[model samples]
Target: MKKILVVDDEFDLLTTWRLVLQLEGYTVVTAANGVQALSLARADPPDLIVTDWMMPKMDGVALCRALAADDRLMRIPVVLSSAAERTPPIEHPLVEFHRKPLSIDSFVEIVARLIGPA
Candidate 1:
């Protein structure tokens, strides 16, 4: 089973994603902020990460930067979601950006494309 880490500040959204991902057959790990997600990734890296852009302790961009900085973690695929119009520079080949108001079908398609079907 593919393991996916999902990070979001909103509790309801986080729980929803976790349940949805889990039901889709991916093992899901969730965090309320990028800080916790980063720590969890370091300890046990997941195949893919789906994160929200704006967060309390650390944002998705910062998490992506930290992942890029780490040699061991740089290759993991990242799916970043944001509601804002502005985008942060995401230079990594494995990183993907998704605007908020994301559809479940589209999100599933993206995940399947990136790391195989759940």
Candidate 2:
């Protein structure tokens, strides 16, 4: 099974995402912020990461940069989501950005496209 790491500061949304991804057949792990997510990734890297743009103790962009700096984590696909006015541009091939208020089907499709079926 593919492993996915989902990072979000909001507890409710995090839980909902975890459940939905798990239901889709992926082994899911979660982190409250980029710091936790980074540690989790270092210890046991996930095949894919889904992160919120605005988070405490390190944002999604910072996390992506950190991951890019590390060869082990750089290959992992990342999906960045934000509700802000504009999404930041990422040059990495494995990184994708999407706006917030995503429908489950759309989100799942992106995930599947990135790392194959959950």
Best by TM-score: 1
What are the lDDT scores of the predictions, listed in order?
0.91, 0.92
Best by lDDT: 2
- Of candidate 1, the 10-residue stretch with the lowest lDDT total is 85-94
**Segments of candidate 2 deviating more than 4 angstroms:** none
Q: What is the lDDT of candidate 2?
A: 0.92
Off by over 4 Å in 1: none
Per residue, candidate 2 scores C-alpha lDDT tens digits across 1-118 of 9999999999998999899999999999999999999999999999999999999999998899889989899999999999986867665568888889889999999999989986
lDDT of 1 by residue, 1-118 (tens): 9999999999998988888888899999999999999999999999999999999999999999999998889999999999997677976667888898788888888988999976
Q: Under the 3 Å rule for N, CA and C atoms, how many clashes does model 2 have? A: 0
